[model samples]
Target: MSTSPVHLWGPVRRAENDGVRLAFDALTEGAGGEPLLLVTGLGANRYWVPDGLCLALAQQGFAVARYDQRDSGESTRLPPVATGNPISALFGRRGAAYTAEDMADDAAAVLDALGWGSAHLLGVSLGGAIAQRVALRHPDRVRTLTTMAAVPADVSGLATLRYIRVGTLAKFARLRFPDTADGAVAAGIAVSRLLASPSRPFDENAARADALRNLDNGLHDRQAQSRQIGAQWSGPRIDAITRPSLVLHGQDDPLIKPTAARAIAARIPGARLRLLPEVGHELPARAWDTIADELRTLAA
Candidate 1:
């Protein structure tokens, strides 16, 4: 089934930390309710988060905000650095641009700009790893922590391979689209389809719509992806995350294995885990209510 088109909560706002500028927006001001910050997956823009999901969370009394990570979307793109083969960089020792710590601080910068001292963290995939680091680095800035389809923060190198689907990575490498605007949209839909569950009849409608709105095509930049994936975390382990946490995974996810979510839940004390059947790497419309309900409960 197709989902609704993306809805912009407000005009894009800027948040600066160190030298990097972040682009963010909120559906709610978060005055009388909990402020929720959404962190999307690797190379994904804030628009990647569906409007229906945000509305669902708003219905549950959450003031939700989503932002573009560094080098993605309207955010500042760092100077080009030679980060050879994104996969090689994934298991490398050093980042070509910045540290993962810097990325975590970006989230806090967005919170500061919004005038919210702290907010609940909801992250997906690479976003989930950032959320975990944010909680560890800035505990006071996080009320609750939730990670979806993410690997553990501390696990890297050969150990990380255990939780990944190598074939999926290969498929990502094979994706080809022109540099044109229409190409960006096509690339976006192609990537979404690859992440989607094989059991479900893939619908390009929602993906195509989001692609049209978020035409930046961050995914096509392999070096930028490398910098993001290569950034190492030297901070506290996930076990140190004391905030109330929830780990959600799709049982049928083809990109990241279910074990990745389990590993995260196991690392964080008292973190709850949920494996959704018939789901995939992409958050389908059918799972929006359940995700909202879980977030509401976690915030309470």
Candidate 2:
């Protein structure tokens, strides 16, 4: 995973994974800090996640780098693994273009680009699954593991049903954001309202602005996301991860049940599980401080 300096919009960090080019942004101001890689989930763009959250994590004596995984955000969009809808790719109906292991290797390449030998890894949902793979395949490159909204390799039908509610399932299946800026804003607001914490007020304007920026900067490809969803898994490797770990889940997560978090905690040796009350699929501002504190202790 070697990197060459590239300038796309600014000083965008770029790396290659299995013939795919990837882009990323770094929070490197913290001197002598450990590298903390933030992995976004599914079709999510790294920029969509507020920089303030990354900064807050950086302030905890770690250098943070959040990146667009291949196929999402500004990263390279490889050729389609299949011929049809991205969702079909998730099931390998056509034949997968890549597997989850390929994506996991991509994360390790980020550390290589930063010239860091090892770093703490954190991920959300699908990103969390990739992080677990990174710890298993490249153990020397991972210092600690933290996951939010992630489930175990072998998921239960009950856990999967949480997201199958009529409204949630319908909205998720028909997710669409237009290319225009206005369209982006509207889509962002809708997505925010859908994915945001129910206990917290929906910040429509904030979501709009974030969506606009993401649309302007990151590339959204349904095929890319679907291929990732459909990617092949190596095995049940979470139990093989030896690093100190933390598993954070929203008690009220509508997409994935809290039981998934406990299942994950049970597999990894010494992994701590913290289920936040009033939290949803997305981590609200209130939980960020608490999560940061937990990460700090994990490093300690």
Candidate 3:
């Protein structure tokens, strides 16, 4: 069996400003649908969204573009951040080389590279925050905005939202990324089971496969995640987003309280909210259709 990751995503490409400055990996696929950009959450890995979800969106007439953000997945790594201790990063004390605004700029650059004047932007968790920034900064590039399990600003300030789950953070801190591929799969299974919706059964085998794919790419840097978290927490309120918007949250989300979704809906003028029963922070395979249907309605 081949461990190579490139085969999964055929015809990988990179988009950037002049001379590979701020360059990142992206793919534009699907047909007969409007242009849509799917932004990944904190991990910022396009692969994390699951191939099935992307394909479903594409099948629903969305010309979907998926990509990785800086210091994440296969994208460019900016200056490094501390990792061994993982405590400073836990508090988001680590300085980041870039901000969520910077990441949003990368998304706009991606649109320019793909020759798209604008596209519907759908983001999950941290990616939702980035999408909001993209709409605020480059209004012309976003046709519609849909955010899932995301907060309007930093995780701490929002009384209804949570900044971080300390217990989960401690769990990750204790985990050591094993050297063997099977070890990586096992590790991923363990984490997925923990993050899966309490109302549903987690598919350990599928989680293992996805984890193995991500592991083949590289380990996520905790410091980089800290910087992203910092930028997200430090944002000016997203009251200026005038784009037609949809905010979806799992009624049973543990990581991000459902109240956070309500807070975000209240902040963005003319935003619609949908609460999925028994859904959690992670998007279960079964929930993809409901999400896609909402996107279709939003697009219309």
* Poorly placed runs, candidate 3 (over 4 Å): 1-10, 17-29, 82-92, 154-166, 179-183, 216-220, 232-236
- Could you tell me the lDDT of residue 238 within candidate 1? 91
lDDT (CA) per prediction: 0.86, 0.73, 0.70
Pairs with backbone N, CA or C atoms under 3 Å apart (clashes), candidate 2:
73-219
Model 2 weakest 10-residue run by lDDT: 1-10
Local error of candidate 2 at residue 225 (angstroms): 1.7
Per-residue lDDT tens digits for candidate 1, residues 1-300, read 113433437778999989899999888433357899999888778877887888888889999888999989899988766764577777665455888999999999999999999999999999999999999999999999999999998887778889999999889878777778988889888988999988888878867877887786786777677788888889988999999999999998998999999889887999999998878887788899999999999988
Superposed Cα deviation of residue 22, candidate 1 (Å):
0.3
lDDT per residue for candidate 2 within 1-300, as digits (tens), equals: 011122211367798887888788776456358889888887777765555566567679888787888878788876765544644544345446776778888998887887889999889988888888888888889899998888774342244444334466456668776667766566656766787667777777766656655563222345666666667776565787898889999887777777779888999999999998878778666777788888999999
Q: Which runs of model 1 end up more than 4 angstroms from their true locations?
A: 1-8, 29-31
Q: List the candidate numbers ranked by lDDT, top first.
A: 1, 2, 3
Model 2 reaches what TM-score against the true structure? 0.87
Q: List the residue pairs that clash in candidate 3.
A: 33-61, 154-233
Residue 74's lDDT within candidate 2 is 80
Highest-lDDT candidate: 1
